[model samples]
Target chain A: MSVMASTPSAPVKPKSNTRLRNTLTFWAFVGPLALGLLVFVYIPIVWGFIISFFEARQTVTPSQFVGLTNYVDMLTDPNFVKALVTFLIFAVFIVPTTFFLSLALALLVNNTTKGTSFFRTVFFLPTACSYVVASMTWRMSIFNGLPFGFANIVLGWLGVAPIQWINKPDPPYFWIVLVTVRLWLQLGFYMILFLAGLQEIDRALYEAALVDGAKRGWQTFRHITFPLLRNTSVSILLLSLIAAFQAFDEFYNVLSTGVGSSSNITLARPPLVYIYQVAMADQNYGRGAAGAFILVAIIIAVTIVQGRLFGLGRAEA
Target chain B: MTVNTQTDTGRRVIDRSERIAIVLNYALLIFLSIIFLIPFYVILRNAFLPSKLITAFDWTWLPMPPSTNGWRDLLANTNANIVDGLRNSLVIAILQTVGQIAICSFAGYGLARIPFKYSNIVFYAILVTLMIPGAVTFVPLFVLVASFGWISTFQGLIIPGLFSGFNTFLFRNFFLNFPKELEEAGLMDGLDHFGVFFRLVLPNSMSVMMSLGVITFIGAWNSFLWPLVIGQRSETWTVQIVLSTFMTAQTVNLPAIFMGAAVSILPLVIVFLFMQRYIVEGVKMSGIKG
Candidate 1:
């Protein structure tokens, strides 16, 4: 330790041997982590892709070569097509709503005066709670059908008919529940993101805008805040889309069971939940694996298109 | 309506704008806060209602009068060992948090500081894993854990969760914002990369570590699906898992269920309330990317 410490102040001499030893030591430290990641995450993912090609059914004499069989079924499966459409509809609803809501909240919280943290905490507190618990609470207290839930009671106060948000005939209503629950939960996380973006802006810009007799309304936002936050907007948009695409837990608990089968709410289930059913409930492992890969492909494709459209990835590169 | 107008500038009429902006800001914030808080209000209000009085409508609106019935029922026969669920949950949450913090920081340090070969490849590998959904890996993971003789034990629950690619990515992402000269200085001072990383880097990155620590601990505490598979025994069930069992009942004691749900969400909410300023600061500080 003393010898190594003395190297900074004392006469420095090149020691090729020590450098080589340090490099070796670094590799040694990294070896276990790399191998673990390979075997656990990477290998399984590779195996998943390979497994997609075969009919890996346990009931028969194990998995065998059924080349293009999985993809063939996947291509023709009506439910898969339906789920894709439904999920597209979900993303369209969720992404924009989350985008604006978080932006609006960030604007609101950016004031950061006394007790602003309280509102921020209250808003973000739900993110810490799980989907299952929130869903259950929503089911019990708020969305209760007739006069049972909070939404109905509020509607009742306004002399309106109770619209079953979850159990309505339109599957999209259920999508709304899923989407809103998702938005409500994730607002604070993104708000934090936006707040971070806000802090990076040069205060001089706001001052300069103020100097030009800018009003409280459009000028402050247009000249000062909006231009500064373009990059953060792209990120929020991408992350929101990804989260909507991967929407699982809320949908799982809110809408009971699978679509085209027996959904207590509506005939709409997202890809991951549908895949979960195909894999776990029906034990259709091969089909389920194929569906998962299909979803992954769609997510990657959509994310790429979005990244290009927003110019986010190009800027990063 | 207070404004900072000590300077004389005909061009910049800022005092009126600042006052108007302050009022508009508070009004807008208060309005947004109402919108943001409605769901939480709904959950909190309805949980205390008597189950029978609850219609599928308006069941959980304003508490007419506070009622303890729901809570009493939810915790009824909580377990043979009363605190076992809470105990197990705490243990798992703490262990997972501590373990993940250690592993992620070390890996993050290695990635950020150690000038090794193929470092970018290693970092990208971590990032790519985030896209692979848990549904894809659950089966193989289940098989792997089962094979390792780790099922239904605390070790099985805690060990697999300790290595998080996302957390590592977050730390390493924030680590770049730090001036490398301090680490370089430490390197010159007799400190190896590991020593510098341990002593100098971590000490400076307390906020990032603290924020991630809270998030990680809460996540571990609320984990259900993984615990469901691994926690085979009744005693092994987390509080959330135990509460979920009530859903399977044909006649759900609503009060009890709500009570349990409320109980589960409380500690997290409390933690957020107390540590939130630091938490938000930490998250913002950590959001800096290369």
Candidate 2:
């Protein structure tokens, strides 16, 4: 322990020598990370904008100037627009429903005095499970789209007719199936966020409200708890939205046609899927890059708007 | 007398409410536990069954008669190099976790404890990168990898995720909470910064770093896109990519895929079971809270 400057300069300004040495050391430590971000992150992002200006087909070499053509095509493109609409519908169905269910789960777990830790761990465990595994499980086992599958098995219990999960039109079965699976894996993660927020709240506030004329159940939550958890709730919501935009794995592996009959319940064009198809399946790198940039723009724009609406700090104070 | 009667009534109501709360609490608990348990059983039972039994869509509490022949077949791949995927994942995860914690601890300590100009800018830049997705950079990184001739190498697998902004940020938060007096004493005794950081700072950070290491291990172990894109060599493929291949299987055995997946997850499950506390703490840092 070296700092004995308790009565020295009040601000304890770091000595100039120390500052210079520290600066060098800090960058030395940060060099690899800074280099990674520059090469792999920042440069590519800016290069994404730059590539949009060029008609760079592959590997960033010998490409022609297609200034604004990609962007123009993206705007006028019918497929892009259709997928955008589909994505909007998907988001609208999933995000709010996921968050509220998470809140309910969190509240349930938070209220239970017995096995509180056990329930929290159990609920949170699935979130750590890989998305590919979860998505695969849903595709093959649970909503396996067969007579004796898990969903149909349960439906049999209630005597309801078996229905295709990702296909049925009237019930909008695809949306429900996709959203339910996503929410099942998702709610636990956010529940922990909500739990953390709950933990941060002053318990004395709840006691004080109880001491006053405030009722125990809803009043305590309404007046004391919910407002305190707003920041965490907003954080969870924003992260979920960001994640939803890049909903690729489920689309890629789970709903994939992968040697299966493509005639069943086809959502053929989520943005990422479309881009992936263009590049990998069809070797259309130009369109793929264009689509990726468009997604980057959409994600950034949406994140900014949400941040403004919710006042998400760049970092907590 | 009326007030006394009213107070008695209120007490009785509170008692009844507590009783109701106790009953309803376990009901919710049972329901939530089922939700968690059911999927696991589905995977487990389905994984052990034959293809015909599996794709038949029978959702039984368990496979009628569990057979280990599927597992025996999978494990029989002694020279099948079934473990190449697991080895690749473990290597990448271990290297990245160690490298990240080492680099980030040094950098985080400096950012939190040392007062340097432009520290905040650097930190903010790292934070901003968190919001950016891997797809945005995939094109350039493709070029970088090709240029390095790392198309199918361990270098490709490890290098891309070597520097983690999230890990750096976590380490910084941990360090900011570190007592400066210990570091000051190290400095007073004439230890240079590196000496102090490695000798003193890291040991104190053993628990936090362990948690971060476990989180990083899981993240790398479970990485998909990067591994799929980078690990083109069959020997370099991580377990996630290998397991995902089963999703594309047509005439493949369901039990074999399950056994493979179960083997893939065995390491993670073992690690998780042992250090769920650190896993929880790591989740707080890498996931839930952030």
Candidate 3:
């Protein structure tokens, strides 16, 4: 190929020149993005790691190094610990719930022969909605702590007393608001993923199963469909786990009193929200940076564990 | 003859069961669809209703004597500066999408096609960045932006978001599968690698580019945390930030808030409706390839 591309006259000199030119072209293509990744991503992360070791109060660049004191302080703080616990409970609740619901939706949508697109569209529409807007809608209108609110209205029809969904966190009905809103916003996106996975399964497999006396609904699914969907399910589980850890916008918009007002509702504050307060609101950059690292460690650890458990890169049967 | 009758009955039984299953499937789909759509219906209805009716003890399915009070209040509220927020969001999302596509695609093509000595090293470096979650770098990135004096500026909002390792990875995957014969033909016509990429590869890869562009645009429009950190000033706020203020502001105007939410969602809804195919395809690709 190189011989054909070189000049007919003075082939040796032209070949070397072409090689040099190819190397330059490669740099021209990849240099800008590599530079960007270094400047924006790599530098900030390294800087944050350094800052986590110091007492960075009201400033990012601190003079005094505190040698893991910031980490110790964050670990010992009840609020920080509580945030971690909150994230744990949230991940426990949301990851499986989203996984199952989205898979169920994909199954339901995929089974239907008519109006499949309509159902998919209706479900996926919420994925386009921002968490801020969805949180507002959930907090103000649907799950608002008033008799006229949507949830209360439904409760009234069911002969249950009007419950203050968010304000009074006792009995912890606030989880209802949080869980349902997140479910509504995310279910469709994951369903689409599962749907794609479902489509890739050979139609002949199901036919073979049926001929082997497998029933259509659960029996076939349990034997064939579910096993085939393992890869999709695992990836979805991982993605949802990450998303649940990053649950700040809804927690902030729904629970906090107002802009810049300290939140009195402290039940479900995730690590990101807590870190945001520590770093942005309280101006304790050291503690906040330390907290951020802890969250990252948890995410990375969970992802690795999940990947190992699933045998992620192993070839499919 | 008796055995034949038995088989016929069994077949009929199976058909009946299948029909019942089909009915149940449609029933569940419709039920779930309504549940999915209820929030949109509620938001739209509430946005057009007066505040009193929104909180009234008696609820109406439809907003009666519909008033534009919410929309009017939202527009007149000077502190929110929602119009400015919308404009800024549009500018930021558009610029970021264009820049990301150009830069990431170029890198992706080179990494996939070019035989550079250090390609593997560069590829692994990019791959490793994907593991570092955004939370780990949020504070320091903010500090970096601040040091550059980019706070409350378009540069802060647009530039940091332009280079996604994941996007570059996607482009590389796409280019790897691109037909080599086409590129060789271009080479035969006396074009260099850059010329072939610009004239042949890019044009042929429009579907992937379009799908990725739509996904990036929607993501940029809907992003919250970074814009909140950087665009502190009202003049630089994205629509998401503006809608957030309506909920968290000192005076919580319920109607105006609903109206703002409705308005903020409009652009994305339009984009989704128009590019629904590409958006879904892009998501499907991410799931399959990631």
Candidate 4:
């Protein structure tokens, strides 16, 4: 070890060989993944972008260049516009609701000295269940519009008439189905995140606040806990925003009359679902690809605005 | 004497309020737990109940005459092909998880540890992909997969999902904090970088691997849209597809759908129950570091 340390520099030939080996090692590790990302992710994205400008119809590779016709069509299409509105409404509703609910759950779990793990596990178990399963359970049993359905049974006991949850979109009771299933599926996952954030708070600070006459519950939380949880809150907000933008599975499963009959449910279609219909069902690949870019653009814009609002990157700097 | 009496009363008041608060906390937690567990209960109850009872106007909290009819029907139904679905889903999920961990760990380790000249460029490129959601790429990806003649094959289901920027990102963060001395020792023993990574780095990374593996498995298992698209053939249908088929079938077999959901969820539930400690730890790590 002493002799090796005393040797100031390796011989030039061996040194170059080592450098070559190091480079080879680096590529050996990173090359497959880079190639994969290029083929699977980057290539498809570029291809999608190119096809979006063409009258691609049934074929992904098209001879005709429509030049923004697909974009214009998607923008003008009422269904696409409504899908954007649906996303906006979903983001507005789910973002804050999930934030508070998860945070509250985290706070409650954090406060408890016993059965913390039990509560955490119980809450998080739903995250394992598939969206299709949750959507089916919620649609068929809980909000099934039948007199025996769980929600209607409660309404019956209250002397109120049974409401058709999904079929009758007039009152938009389906939003309840949509929102509740989403909440059940995702609430615990985010709660676990918030719980992690809550645990990071300095216990000493809470004690200091207590000695300084800050009340135990709300006062202490407001001044100390909430302020410290800014980072977690911002990240959770961003994640939920992206999730809202990508809302497809639940909406498609719940609202659609059935498989192959997805075109029937015209109400509450998110952009992905709408794009899916345009591309896969109708074989209008150009419009579908175009709508996808539009959605991506909106997502990027929202993320930027949210980052600015929350001062996301500035804190790290 | 008056001061002492006043202090005792103050202590008593504080104790009573604290007790009430504790009780309220437990009450709220229990209430939330019930709400959380209701869907699971509903699934279990309805899966065992007869179709007539399930659709009846009178609500039964429990399946009084518990029956195996739904489970039997789900297994016996040929079009549903639940057994095939389960096998396909398991194979796809396992392959995807293993492949993802391998590639992501390699890229992550390289980006984090190797002094490669263009590593930053590659890292940023990978990060940029995270912004491009899967919905944006599935169409052309579908076309590309079709071009490869991989539609309805395991290659279509598992291969595209193997390269997740998010997983790579997490792995990079993890490896960045890995002890350098251990790798230096391995290098001193004349092991190459590959050797060090395989023998030294990966073995010590069981926790992160287990956690990420569990996550990837669950995601792959529960994935709906991709499989729904790629695995259009009944032979390649995953459990999720099978579950969706029950609802989408012309008859809408409620009993069979519930049973399928219960079965579909079972593997993940077992996985979660076993690896929950690592799972929670993973979430905490990601939340704090990500």
Candidate 5:
């Protein structure tokens, strides 16, 4: 492993003749993708940061360089602040619920005697379906603010009046719609992650635990299964956290009016939706770019904190 | 005799618990499956029902005497060009998938096998790009593409998404763990790196390649925000954008929108049903590695 680690940088000893050809081959293979990443990803990121410092909008060039002013203005902007709080509330609600639900499903599916793949497929089928399709199905048909909506229909049978699920504000049932759609879309993917982790644990470990008098399922799971799954669980949590921070599709599709309109944005609006509204709809590219960095900083900070808490890269003892 | 009796009791207890667990598992799975299937059921039921029937307060789990009015209206609706959107989506998804596989796999091979000086540095550089949230680059990327006069064009939609940092990492990891003997044999047979990659590596990489291809296609097909931004023109709209348009319109026609949604999801559902094993493997690969 150590030799392989140093192999790329270490100079080849005997192959002195084809050195030029080898270098050329390397460039031919890597150049296009590296160029693509440089131009599309790296350059844009730098340009975005530079533009954030200036008052730029509706044009490629910044009109003026007002250092950190865009950031300050966005920080004070009530809409941006509201959007952040909304995202936190969303992340707080979503991450743990998704984690636990997926873990439970994975445990259940893993323990099943027969038809494991069938259940796995059934659960994972939603992950294949796009957020757009799921959101549309949810917003228009299932949770539409009509008396005949799916949830309302369920409510009606219980002798309750129909409630406006999508449009409701006071109790904010839209959260339910948003949360459930996201859960439906993502739970199976994470469950598969946990299932993979579950499968990776040594069967011998379980037998040994059983032989050592750990007869109860929970005891084995606690001592053998859960500890062994630490890496998968940590990464799953990290991915979920990042995904939550990046939440845009379902909320935007389900909550907002169409593109170029932010009329219905409230409560459940995520940071991306707000930045998109500001940058695209309002055409305030500077603040939008600044807000993007702000969101990135928060995500990075959270990730670092998570990494520290989990000792993420540390090898198991 | 004592040992035989003890083992018998143990086996019986195990059977009882296992049997109970089986019953519980099926029961739980059945209940959750119904919940999971409900949204799909709604979409399918509404897709074939008349607008009035779909929106009516009466509740039925499945459409009774299913009508084709929704599908008809969906096709007739001016705002949603379902056929054109489907064609455009297919074109974009296919292009993006082919582009990523070709680009990332080559890059991965170079990083893994070529052993160029500074290759490690280059790899680390690519990996670091993953740290930068995609949102940070969103606006400027639009501007960059727009400057190239690519906005609302296939270039705009396809070029920017053609390569991915994560995919490159996946391919690199795959190649690093790939059998070196095959490459050595190909080299011994006078095959250059390119020839070896084409004849030996890629053919052997069907599993990872297919996994990447399926996931990428699904992603490209379902992508909403980018296409919504870049494909603003009605003629260039992807299926997802069209679906979003149907729902977010000022006056949403429920039955028609569901019909559109159902149509968009039909291909994916088929793909999932047939290639579910690959899909699960792809997702598993993604999770385990990370």
Candidate 6:
């Protein structure tokens, strides 16, 4: 209530009087954040790069400087190659599925007239649910390979035998468990993004299209809605790509049964999981750091190439 | 006459199709809602059912005579340390949220309102960090924290994440659009810039603060990998790390697992239900700016 600017007093301060104080205040405000970024982000990233050139495993200090050996080792390692290939497969599977599904969901919710808020909340509830919980739910209750598990229970209804979703890595149907959990967790978040984009479209454009012979919803969407939603769609795709590459939680937790099972590593380990194993589990921080940089390179290259292809940040066509 | 009769039939056909469409729409929505809700239902039911009866899936959809065995077991299990995990997570999340709000908003206000020569450079430097994926810095950050002997300490878990670049950017953008008149009035009354920020600017920032606070709190609470690595000791483990321990252990207690999962996410679900509008609004805000 006291936030009004209508008080009667001097409107403008003498500029020179407060300049020095202003400068000091400015630094006081911005200093902490800059210091945080430097210590946590900038310095650590540089250290990560420097450590990748040496053999700094199992110890805090780096004494041996085998330039490019760590990088070369990771590049040639079968496990690293396997991890990259696995992530690529995952990205390929998840990116489009999530994009299309979220868009479809956004369209559905947008079309609804009543209980719109109710449906939106229900769909968005999973976004609040942690991936750890979701992964556990999927692993034990849904796809546990038991006769009475949720997926198997449904399979029984069709007179089919229960499938070992996580254990059968030969054909790799575990992708179902991985992909579905991510889809359920992320779809509603992206749906909200699409809804925001949809809300921004001019109603007049739709009315005009309908009046000028666009009698079907599909036609109107094709000519106007889809094109206008391009920016949101591109951003969603880019974010999904980044997230897919960073896929670790569900993959690590769901596939591994916690004891003496080396199957999870060879099953579908992503770059982060691979790096975690190499660094923490094996005590090879040098190689782990190198693997991290390599993964970062791939992510950067993909992002730049995708941005160019999509003309992301460019004015609308 | 023929054209008029044709129009009449066409309109009736459209009405009948519209009726069918509405029915089909509700059916599809209801079907998907059930699909979305089943996992939650299963977890909730299993959390209340006795551990022995958990695997006996005779449509255990609703817990019969709902027992508290799972909750009792989880709280009593010393190795699990679910309560301690929850406490640590709360400390980290709350302190980190407070720190972020203070640090980011101050910098945001400085960048947006203060007429400084190097502000743009500072802003862009922070922005550039966003492009670098967190994977690039993960190992070295852990190394640095370890060197400081901060492993299993609150400083290690909380300090590095105190300020978010994206959040600082959000605050800057929000402050830029903020009404300058309020601050100008404060200045007219002999209040300095800092005074104005404290008295007027911050009070008016309730909505943005709430949005960022909730989002950041949820993120900090649900974070797994970082806490798993940093808080290796059972004493310092966050709720996520503790729950994940169940996944990695030799013995799997189904009821305890469900209950732990349920309890881990309970705070977020409560916050979301009560402030659903703000959360949705927050998503929209991020989408527009992002």
Best by DockQ: 3
> Candidate 1: DockQ?
0.38
Question: Roughly what TM-score does model 1 have, to 2 decimal places?
Answer: 0.85
Q: Lowest summed-lDDT stretch of 10 residues in model 3 chain A? A: A258-267
- A186: Cα error in model 5, Å: 0.4
lDDT of 2 by residue, A96-121 (tens): 99788888888888887778888887
CA lDDT scores, all candidates in order? 0.71, 0.73, 0.87, 0.87, 0.85, 0.85
lDDT string for model 6 (A1-317, tens) is 34355444324443554676677888888999999999999887788788889889897557699899999999999988988899889988999999998998888888889978888888999988888999999998898878768898888888888888888777787899999999999999899999999999999999888779786568888999998998898889888888888888898788866554565646888888888878877878888888888887887788778878777446454
How do the candidates rank by TM-score, highest first? 3, 4, 6, 5, 2, 1
Instruction: List the RMSD of every prediction in angstroms.
Output: 5.4, 4.8, 2.6, 2.8, 4.9, 4.3
Clashing pairs in 4: none
**lDDT (10s digit) by residue, model 4, range A1-317:** 97687576657656788778777888888888999999999988788888889988777676589999999999999889998899898888898999999999999899899999999999999999999999999989999888989989989999999999998768888888988899999988899998888887889998998889787888988889998988899898888888888888999888887646544357788888888889888988888888888878887787778768667565655
Which of 1 and 4 is the better model by DockQ?
Answer: 4
Tens-digit per-residue lDDT, A119-195, candidate 5: 88888888867898898888777787888788888888899998888776878898998999999999999999999
DockQ (C-alpha based) per candidate is: 0.38, 0.48, 0.74, 0.69, 0.70, 0.63
How would you class the docking of model 5? medium
Global lDDT of model 1: 0.71
lDDT of 1 by residue, B1-290 (tens): 12344355532566767678788888777786787677666656656777666654333446789788876665565442224776788899998888788778777767776766677887888888776655435544544565577778888888778777777887777777789889889988999777887799889988778888987887788776678667878877887677666654556677677767777788888888788876676566444421
What proportion of the real contacts between chains A and B does each prediction keep?
Answer: 0.34, 0.37, 0.72, 0.66, 0.72, 0.60
What tens digits encode model 1's per-residue C-alpha lDDT throughout A152-265? Answer: 677878898776777776544566567767877888888889878888898887778766877655778886788779888877888777767776667767767334456663
Kindly report which residue stretches of model 5 are placed more than 4 angstroms away from their true locations once superposed: A1-17, A259-262, A312-317, B1-14, B288-290
Query: What's the TM-score of chain B for every model shown?
Result: 0.77, 0.89, 0.97, 0.95, 0.93, 0.95
Q: Which scores greater on DockQ, model 3 or model 5?
A: 3
Error of 2 at A218 (Å): 1.7
lDDT of 3 at A244: 86
Give the better candidate number (5 or 6) by DockQ: 5
- Measured with C-alpha atoms, the lDDT of residue B100 in candidate 6 is 88
